[model samples]
Target: MAKYSEKASKKVEQAIHTEKEGKLRTGTGKKVTSRKQAIAIGLSEARKEGAKVPQKKD
Candidate 1:
């Protein structure tokens, strides 16, 4: 199992809350309507922040 850092987890939580409150928007100015997409965005942000997130394994 891969482990995500505290910061990454926090970002994911924030994204979830933002999505639930209809406060999340994409870069193209479109509203985010999916929880999974919000989570992906959060993880991407966490990666940009240098969090210890592992790459997806397939």
Candidate 2:
């Protein structure tokens, strides 16, 4: 199992919340409707902020 930092978890939570509220968007401006995508976005953000997240799979 992969371990995520507190910050990464918080980011994922926030992303999920925003997605449920219909306020999350993708880079192309499309509304995010999938839970998996929301988590991906959160992890991406966490990675950008230097959170302890695992490397993205190809």
Candidate 3:
């Protein structure tokens, strides 16, 4: 796997944790149902925070 910044990893961890707790949600306020979705949400948040995440694919 590609190396991620510490902050980026932390964000993903937090998101996974929240998902496991059944507290993760989407923009439409729908409950999160997939691991990939959670990670994507985490990376999106990290990007918004200007963390050292890799650029998203087009």
Residues 1-58, candidate 2, lDDT per residue (tens digit)? 9999999999999999999999999999999989999999999999999999999989
lDDT string for model 1 (1-58, tens) is 7899999999999999998999898889889999998998899899999999998556
Model 2 regions lying over 4 Å from their true place: none
- Candidate 2 achieves a global lDDT of 0.99
Question: Each model's TM-score?
Answer: 0.89, 0.98, 0.92
Off by over 4 Å in 3: none
Leading candidate by lDDT: 2
Candidate numbers, best TM-score first, in rank order = 2, 3, 1
What is residue 36's positional error in candidate 1, in angstroms?
A: 0.4
Model 3: per-residue Cα lDDT over 9-58, one tens digit each: 99999999999999999999999999999999999999999998888999
Error of 3 at 36 (Å): 0.4
Evaluate residue 44 in candidate 1 and report its C-alpha lDDT on the 0 to 100 scale.
Answer: 87
| Candidate-wise lDDT, in order | 0.92, 0.99, 0.94
